[model samples]
Target: MKRSRELQEELDSDSETAGTQPTIRPVFKVTQLDSAIDDELDSFAMRCNLPPHREALAFKTYDEYEVHYNKSHTNRCLECRKNFPSEHLLNVHIEECHDPLVTVKREKGEHTYSCFVEGCERKCMTHQKRRMHLIDKHMYPKNFFFAVTRDGIDGLSAPRESPRG
Candidate 1:
């Protein structure tokens, strides 16, 4: 898509490039990871709980649910029945208060890292294991990360034709 001036202005304001490179805007590629997350959240059951009689509401992203929760719930879990003061407390509870009985490796450099998809307890000691989990366990397309991460070879990277031709 052609870059618009309004988009350029928005990007320029937020990016470190500022006026350095006025034409560049990083493009994001949606992958199975995003789809998986969205699919799980497509039927968010907690949103409609604000009004006792209201029907359940669906959210495409966690941020949307968080916004609704911050405004309406004050403190609640997206997938849990328990109520809390806010996400800050929830995060604190996990980071500081949670018992050592649970094993969720959040550090990237750690020997083991939690799965990319939520609700998946499997941890990975290597990048290949993580990729295998996504592919084997989740049945994600083998090429899902093809262009995004350049993980596998495909016809995506076309050879540039000679200008003379």
Candidate 2:
């Protein structure tokens, strides 16, 4: 029994020492061909996502100088000199070329009204223009007239009133 116990303790210590040895594995491995194959797969996947109409359409690149010939010669346009990768470029072009910076003088009896909202004094010439201004600038709530009441007017009483006799 004492011999068996001594043999068992010796075997356990040998196994623990063997487990502590570091493992050897492959490292720093990738080739140019592997990277090329990855890039090709990514481009192929992107091409597959496009619609049939878009895929059929030919890719066209136009000369910017030829596109803006009139503006290039006469005016000092920054947009012509450089490319702006945004939807705002057209708006900037129109404001710079067609529209004058100073306010235009209006003739007598021009159709204009002060904005109905308090603190806003902008004059709008048409109902559509006023509605647009309210929507874009003030961010006024839709159904505001029904949902809100003017300072002097009672909401319940105004709805119940008959036409003036």
Candidate 3:
């Protein structure tokens, strides 16, 4: 763990160039003892009959427990170091938050589609812009179901040459 932290610091410092955010995904190590304790604790939570581990390390502080829990039990986002309780939520987080970083690389260098709302003339060039237009201008919720494309809103016209955001 110490070695990994040192390596992460080195990577972060190297990547801290002007106008760029450090995007290194920090690695995590899950010890066998932690894995066993997590499994046993889940079983205990479900009211399953199980004996406590004789050698499980007792956490001393909230921070200790949180760190161990995040490392051993949670679906963690390495890029941002946020932990999700379930795999579905982790995937959703990746889709909504981190996936845009990849999609931005695929932009065609132009605005491809107009806003989905009726009577709205805003043209959006990327996934985040399209999403923001709906959320900010039309009061759409962050998790709104409008696909980032014209076909998603209305299929009345021919498809654009640009890809779906």
Instruction: Using TM-score, give the best candidate's number.
Output: 3
- Candidates in order: C-alpha RMSD to true structure: 27.7, 22.6, 25.7
- On lDDT, the stronger of 2 and 3 is 3
lDDT of each: 0.49, 0.40, 0.53
Give stretches of model 1 more than 4 Å off: 1-111, 146-165
lDDT of predicted model 2: 0.40
lDDT of model 2, residue 86 = 23
At residue 120, candidate 2 shows an lDDT of 64
Task: List candidate 2 segments past 4 Å from native.
Answer: 1-111, 146-165
Q: Could you estimate the TM-score for every candidate?
A: 0.24, 0.23, 0.25
Top lDDT model: 3
lDDT by residue for model 3 over 56-159, one digit each (tens)? 55554557766655444466566665544445445545654566653564464655444655456666666678878767877777755544221121222432
> Any residue pairs clashing in model 2, and if so which?
none
114-164: candidate 2 lDDT, tens digit per residue: 444555667666546766676667776554441211121221343222111
As a whole number from 0 to 100, the lDDT of residue 132 in candidate 1 is 75
Number of the candidate with higher TM-score, 1 or 3: 3
What does candidate 1's lDDT look like per residue over 64-90, in tens digits?
Answer: 878765544654333333333334334
